[model samples]
Target chain A: MTHSDQISDSDQMPRSAWLCEYLARLEDEQVMAQHGDARILAPAHRLELDPEGWATAAKVAAAMGLRHAGLWADCLDDSALAAEDRAIRMQACLEHAGDYLVLETQVPMLRPVLASQASIYPGVDRLERHAHDLTGLELTSQPDGRRWTRHQAWPEDRFPLRGDFPLAGEPVGRAPADADYPFGRVQGTGVYEIPVGPVHAGIIEPGHFRFHAMGEDVLQLEERLGYVHKGIEKLAVGRDPAGLARLAGRVSGDSTVAHAWAACQAMERATDCIVPARAQALRGLMAERERVANHLGDIGAVCNDVGFAFAHLQCGRLRERWQRRSQALFGHRLMMDAVIPGGVAVDLCDKVVEELREDHAQLKSEIVPIFDVVADHPSLDDRLMTTGVLSEADARQLGCTGYVGKASGLAFDVRRDSPYAPYDGLAMDGAILAEGDVAARVRVRMAEIGNALRWMDRLLKSLPDGPICAQLPEAEAGAMGLGIIEGWRGEILSFIRFGPDGRIARYFPRDPSWFTWPALERLIHGNIVPDFPVCNKSVNGSYSGQDL
Target chain B: MFRILKKSFQTGVVTETPPDVADAEFERIGIELRRRIDVRFSRSLAIRQVDAGSCNACELEIQALNNAYHDVARFGVHFVASPRHADALLVTGPVSRHMEAALRRTWRATPSPKFVIAAGDCACTGGEFGASYASCGAVEKVIPVDAKIPGCPPSPLELLQGLLHVLRG
Candidate 1:
């Protein structure tokens, strides 16, 4: 069949109907779809399937108006898919010689060519672009042909995601030296270009935002990232599985638990290994704590950026105390290396739990007053209230997640939708609002802090006792795994493929920053250049995270 | 004010140290210059942090050193905005090809007496990213590294020690 002919016939249905039926089918199959009101899930069996069968299933999912939720193909035995077809359709290749694919195609991509899915599933715009970027697979009828992730690092002809790409260092050509990148400009009469930083005033990560403006109000903002791109994807290829988890932890310093959990989940899914229930709970606790810590810091930083130094000072104090408590309990301020492959590295002792409970109590009692001070003051709100508004529609279109999404009224949290581990056992009230402005973002942070405090209290009150980690079965060649964790930021998706003797064949971590960074550019419209710092702080897409 | 006072009370009374004892003492045999030298310190350092596509472990260590225990201000190496005013460039991770230009820009931004301290295995050489295609593999590739601090994620103390070396440089 021609490539266009491969497009399934069922792509014309309305998304609402398709989503409902998919969820119903998942429920019928005893697989539950969590927090996303629109998301659905279906499980696959352990046996190997044909490439055509896999493609057909993806086509059906696409036709049903469901994007691929990411595939987790676990190759446990030698009897996986046949070699020729496996080279193309496998979501990630395995070290154990096992096969798995986790594809997240938009509702629009399921149909045959002529009518592309990008128009319908706007959320998949960057996603499909990135997928094509990494895997070098041709996404038929993709909206734009521009290079998404490719720079001068690798051979232009060679695709890095291919199994044949060298893991060893290669001397590459210089990056695109032209000062002007493909950033769209405003069409108004008085629009001017205001280029700001791959470097900035504060100690934030490097991201250059090109603003097209008419007078004081921003007409448009386009972000050019990848300044700190380390080729983390290439580094992960052929690494030990455990090593990948450690690497995942640092994908974003503040997002350790989420990224680690996502990577670990991918590994577990591929191995078909179920972590102990308690480990799952502890992981959730860690994720929540991370979320709280970052939110606290950001709230303070936002205030500081706006010249409200008292709130900044107080928040800084609280944040410092929180980090100290974390250090006292987990041995690192940021809880680095506290999460491991099979489970967590740090487990809560009774003392640690008690200490955490004490900290939570203090935070809960004090935060309200601090936020009150923040709210009562006009200057703080004046700078924050409607500055950098990311409209609700734009949030959905850009697939903004975490506090940014919730602030903009997109109520998608992996914890609630996916319902993995401790999040399912405990309630996650992801505070959401629809204003889509800086103030709403701050409010979301405040609300999330309150919720996180509650989560900490609950976790401490009923701290689980168990072995923190488990010895994994020696991964044979071609073993594959998928990890999905709702990091403090949002969904952290890690796809791992193990080579023979348990080496990572390929590791891809989709940090939430990937989706959220673009949102920063979109949200800055109508705001003056001076307020960019506060707006950027409110969104706080990680430069390191996105670079990785 | 009352709430602050109450919080102080809740924290319990911290015994005041005597002037002579509180300060680190230095004595001459005959003339006891009892003029105690209080270690006057500043909590700010004009720090220039360099990134070499690090796993960010060393960066985390640097952040940890700034946090509670080994607070950089105790020795004074704060993360500053511009390198022109920075006392040191705390370089982290293996230098990647993409960051090479930025690293050079940052290095040139610094004024005289500026020290470049490579803060991790990756910063010292191409840590893991060294073998990979994306790596330029060390701070020396872009700038002369004054000190190399080793460890996957060097302990907060090690980072502090590296800073000390830079301060002394």
Candidate 2:
């Protein structure tokens, strides 16, 4: 522990002896920033460390029951240092309670390898792979070494997210047919494989799923995804705060509001900008509406996959109406780009608020009876029950959240636990189930929809009278900030660093899909092949969200 | 199912009347479409949708085409699973490099006389996710687009209009 920080620490110390005792085990450690109950900033303790200290710190943090939140990388170009010393810096963010403990370390360009966090947090398998894929820096024990974000679009030697690489990659013709990418072999008696798609039949995102099954039961399911890798990470560099917020919104179109808000929050934090109370409430409203719309659509789609056309039609109608309402209020149906760096672009007048309340009331009456019919249907009950069951152990290990984790008894909701603004005062009952089945997931979604509807009502009732936005001060060079939000699917984390003249040096929005997608492989292990679609729908991992 | 049926009976037909002259709010829009449609193809149009790396915002609006209000099915336009049965390809997003080939394979799979509708700002001009190391901007860069629907995600009404324009042409 550092002498300077021990005497000058901001948050005082020793609420828990565990944290203090653990830090005493390490050398050259000190708290970076303390943000207890801050409206915007995470109550994070940042530790600047050498390479060896970082790997050991991660292991210790994991043992202390800290959940691995996210990892992000950017090249650190120091003008004073020799060219060789300028290195790729990677930061690992870990969460315990509402606090985020961040570890930072740099690896020189010559042999850019570091110990992986996969041993501690198995969920970091993809994050390390993503760091490796984009920065060309290798992690010593990354669970998988295969290409991730780059796909085969870029050549072996070229790392697209590196500072030297141009935005336009020099392609030597069409990318070599990706047909030869290796798939896991499940060699046993009568174990065969079915490759689904990078291109699906219906209106859906692209991801290639390889299922190795014995008879009809799936023995192994390995998903090869990156078909939607849009070079968003590479594009994020050099953008202004507003531009970066727009890019974040597209990280996952469905979670547009949440992602944008997270990015904006990160930007606002970096610049020390405090948004108006009204703006925070509006953001909450938008995020909850997004959650409701997606749940409505998904509930219907799950039924549609099972051939319950009536439920499908009813849900579709409801979703459309909901989207229309969003458009009328937020100026975009999906609410894309509604959130900016300082505040929201649109403000709701009294008339709009009144209409929204009436619409909310009307929708409750309209959807409840239809949902009841589907809930009682014998055919649906037979299909969804006990199918693709993800156990509590698997859910916790995979770090799944939102409905997927809630269905399987992982009672972690970022909003309730973290208590960010607009949600700080709202009482959350937590819709959780231990069943770990498809039916349980549907029930969780239904419960969440009701909760979100009420949350909106509460937010509107206590809407503060103030300016919708605050003018943000100009960004300071090399400032860094982290933003985390409870998105519809789960907790989304955004990391932002500013370059010279306030241009973005790096921005990475870590989607909750990274945790949820891997768990799909586990949940679908013994499920039948035909049931994959419904199982996948129940999980509903976003391809774009993860690939980015 | 019986309860659902009873509710359906109580609600009567939730489906809109013939959109032309049915919704007076869009009389001018209906007249605009009625005037511009080329009417070269048959009345019925079968659509095959290919998501070329969209964030799926466009796909949601496209799916809404099947819902009650903007029922494109009532307009003799429905989404078919197979490209062989399709008359037009409704493509979305700036084609990611990984999806570029699969999109071509889909185009090749469709029978002759197929039209491609680049159905978003991304598909039309690479929108925000521009042509880059991992993305090949615009559906037009890889394949020809007959019609372009431009919006971050074109709304269901806008998509319906685009489809009507294609059917009329």
Candidate 3:
């Protein structure tokens, strides 16, 4: 179908119905469809597909303009199935609008192989490699089969996510340098490479960037991350719901609130726990605060990159004040551990609510004028405008989300598109622009900060008076839950499965950085090498979030 | 331009005075740190931060030290881009296996008479993600550490105090 044809159909029908009709047209008999649990706020349609159907579904989904949301694999340790059927279950999440469909296929433990989806959705490249690295799965017809989460840490034969493989793998005395990892070569006279950090000059997370450049202009930029991989999945294998929430909060410390909420949402849904209305509102409030704080810091950092020290300091000061308020009200600066399995850990009394209101007003007054100055600054505009532009077509293909995608005209906000409790009937605005440059990204952040402040005001006014938490009931073994949250950076998808003894069987929190990180590589094609920092800051993919 | 200047003028010098050394142990360390700074390396202390394998929370707090509130530069402590120019290395996270070599290289690159201060519980004692096949628990496991600032992530004030304590020795 043509783009126009599909758009018309998509506009006429609801997203779920349109998607269901499209999937039906694929005519794959092996595709088994089932409706997800009604308890889930954004319920996903589960699809059990054969190996052939798995590869075809991804290709068909791409053709139908479905965004590749997430891809993860879980090792099944059940001995009840025959040896031929004893397998690893691989799941691919495809999303369009607010609707979600999970495509699952089981690959046998002996010679686990599947067709690669990277050719269709470029964002799935690293995730497929990650699944392969951790679960010993092989991808046939793959493009760029380089090892991604395995950098001389584990031998070729060993896979950390296997049930038999111990959490604490055989510790080596010293790890060797990953110098031999092949980087794609751009052949030309004076086409040199600038290799930047696993340890950057600035105080940030570790990830290496290889820039193929000639003179000042960059030819290509490739990112080699996963330096912060701490066996998050392996460590999460047997954690209780509370323990899992703590682990999730740390997935990306900056995004602590969002990650924790997503994990908790997943677990809460799996166990059919009904979170109290007050707790839901508080969670929304905390998430908005988190978004504002990060945006303030980022807007300033982007300015700092272009040598705008005044904006940087002002933004930083405001962000520090914002986080200090969070610490006072929510108990943690990042609001980590505030969102538990069923509900929130802290509640706002009248006095605390008043304090929050006063702080919000103070922040709004201070930041508005600063943003005005930033938006109108001539020198800032000269550097940021039309620099490192990510085309909308490229963005759609890469499945970019949050400000990065919205700035580029691919407006897909999880909060607005898939409204959960607290946001269902809330008055909110999404900031979208088609400029797709550093300035656009910064503008998106500024707009988001304003919206969050307004939302917080509304939530504080309508603050419900009730219990802050609900007890999570026990879920039967093999029960799965999915949580999709709109974090500051972008969409955060968390998948959770409960074990027989009420412990976590499998947990995978896919950060939006998994998709946006590739967009950075695409956007930085012809930009000058020095502009890389500003461009990178604009996209600012979470190293720890994706690395986990 | 006028608005920017006017705003700057209105927000003049928002930096606050450092918190008074109330605790006896901290006061002792503060005095010792002052003496060391005067005698060994002038007043300025340059630190190179290495994210060994942190959740990035510690890094955020570390960055906060430079803001207008803390303004750690005024305290004669500032972050440097290179380890060679650093008097100490401020490291965070439970050293992941992939970063082991990089961390060691960084430590070796620092000049003699340099200290390594482990920031956050992960760096101090591996926090929640303890030693696994992928991680080498704690910063000290890979390289010698002089002092440890412990919290899931120590606050900016605690980090400043931790830096002062390490400077004392």
Candidate 4:
């Protein structure tokens, strides 16, 4: 049957309903549909699919306009399954509107291979390769099968995520260089390559960017990341709920609040624990503050790239003050480790609430004028406008989200699209633009800062009265949960499964960078090499977040 | 131009004084650090930062040193683009195995008499993501560290103090 024949009535039904109906039509006897844990904020549906159903599901989801959210896998202990059964379970998360559908398929240990979904969702290419490198899962019919996240740290035969692999695997005195990894070559005399990083010139995370350019115009920009992969998933094994929360916070330092919240949310959901209303509101408050701080820093960095030191300096000052307030209120500069499982670690009192209101108002007054200056400046506009354009079609195909996607006209904000606690019943405007350029991304960030400030004000005014944290119950072995949060960058999808003795079996925190990083490669097609820094600053995909 | 000038004038001098040393030992170390910088390095230091495998939180705090609040450059300290031009290497993270070669290459590229300051708990003690199949543990394991700053991510003020301590040596 043709792809359209399967989803002919998709338009007539709600997207989630149509998606569920489509999956149900797959007609595999092994396939089972069940309601996910109640604490998972989104309307979640889990399905067990055969290998054939797995490949077909991606095609159907793509045809139905469902965005490919994430792809991850975990190795199941051999003893846990029958001798003939598969030893690895792979999950593909697909989203429509705010609804999440998780598709699961098992792979045998000896020949662990599955059909690749990269053809349907181009962003899954890296994730599939990463899974292969870490879990020894191969993909048939894969596009670009280069090893990702493996840089001569371990041998080809070793799969670190496997149950038999020790957490502190055979250590070597020195790791060999990864000089043989093949980079896509651009032929012709005029096309030359600019190799940058793994150690950048600035105070930034490490990732190699190979730019094939003809003089100033960039033909292709390929990034080789995973330089910051510190075995986060391997380290997460056997960690208790609290310890896992701390590990999750470091998934991306800048995104500590969001990543921790996602991990904690997943754990809480898996254990069916309800976070108190007050704690939920506090988490929301910290998340919004994180959004504000990151946007401010990004806007400044973008300006600095184009010689607009005025905006850079001013934004830097404001960001410092903002972070100081966060430290005073939450006890950490970046507010890291503040969002624990079952609720928040810190609580707000009337005094701090009033102080925050004053700080918010002051920040608004101070930042608005600077933004006005940046918005009206001709030099800044000339540099940023029409540079690094990512078309709307490319954005949708890559499943870009957050400011990067919103600027390119893919308007999907998890907070607004799939309303969760604290954001539910709250009216918030999504800042979207169609220019798909550096200027548009900056404008979206400015708009988001304003929206977050307003949201924080409302949250403080209607502060819920309850305990900050709740007691978490032990989760049954093999229980699974998912958390999808709208971080400052974009949508962050976290997956967790409980092991024996209530420890974490598998944990995967998929950052929005997974999608946006590919979007960056597409966005820089014809931009000059000099503009790459500004374009990069505008997108600002978290290297550490993606590396992990 | 007029608006920009007016704004800059209104937001004049947000820079603060050098952070105060709490204990007598640190105060003594601070004085010695100042004297050594004046004597050995001619009162100017260029630091090259290497993020071996950090979560990028340490990088943020390091960048904050140059902001208006800290203005570390005013104290004769600045970040350089190359190791050859640097007098010290400020490293962060647990030194992942993937980054092992790169970190060693960076250290060897720096000239002699260059100090290496391990910034953040990860660089000092490997933090949460300690020695693993994928990580090489503390920075000192791969390179000799002159000083260490311990925080999940050391604050900008703590980073300054760490830099000073290393420079004193």
Q: List candidate 4 segments past 4 Å from native.
A: A1-16, A24-42, A78-83, B16-35
Over A417-531, each residue of candidate 4 has an lDDT whose tens digit, in order, gives 8767878757567899999999999999999999999888988899989899998789898777788788999999899999988999899999999999999999999899999
Clashing pairs in 3: none
Ranking by TM-score: 3, 4, 2, 1
Name the regions of candidate 2 deviating beyond 4 angstroms: A1-18, A24-41, A78-81, B17-43
In candidate 2, what are the lDDT values of residues B79-155, reduced to their tens digit? 89888898789999899898988999999999989899999999999999988877789999999889998988997
Q: Could you list the CA RMSD of all candidates, in the order they appear?
A: 8.7, 4.0, 4.5, 4.8
Q: Report, for every candidate in turn, its global Cα lDDT versus the true structure.
A: 0.62, 0.81, 0.86, 0.86
Worst 10 residues of 3 chain A by lDDT: A1-10
Model 4 residue A530 CA deviation (Å) reads 0.8
The best candidate by DockQ is 4
Query: What is the TM-score of each predicted model, taking all chains together?
Result: 0.79, 0.93, 0.95, 0.94
Q: What residue pairs clash in candidate 2, if any at all?
A: B38-B168, B39-B168
Model 1 chain A lDDT-worst window of ten: A92-101
What would the per-residue lDDT of candidate 1 be over residues A6-47, giving only the tens digit for each residue? 113113333334344644654454443342211111121122
DockQ of each: 0.31, 0.73, 0.82, 0.83
State which docking tier applies to candidate 3. high
Tens-digit lDDT track of model 2 for A1-548: 11122223434654446556557655435423232332223345666667766667776776677778878777775456677887998888777666666777778976787888777788878888888888888887666777766667877777777766888978656754478888889998898989999878788888999999999999999998888888888899889888999999999999999999989988877787778888888988999999999999999999999998887888887887788788878889999988988788999899888889999898888878888986788999999999999999888776788999899998788898866677777766589999999999999998898888887887788898888888877888877777878998998989888988888988889999999898899999889999999999999999999987
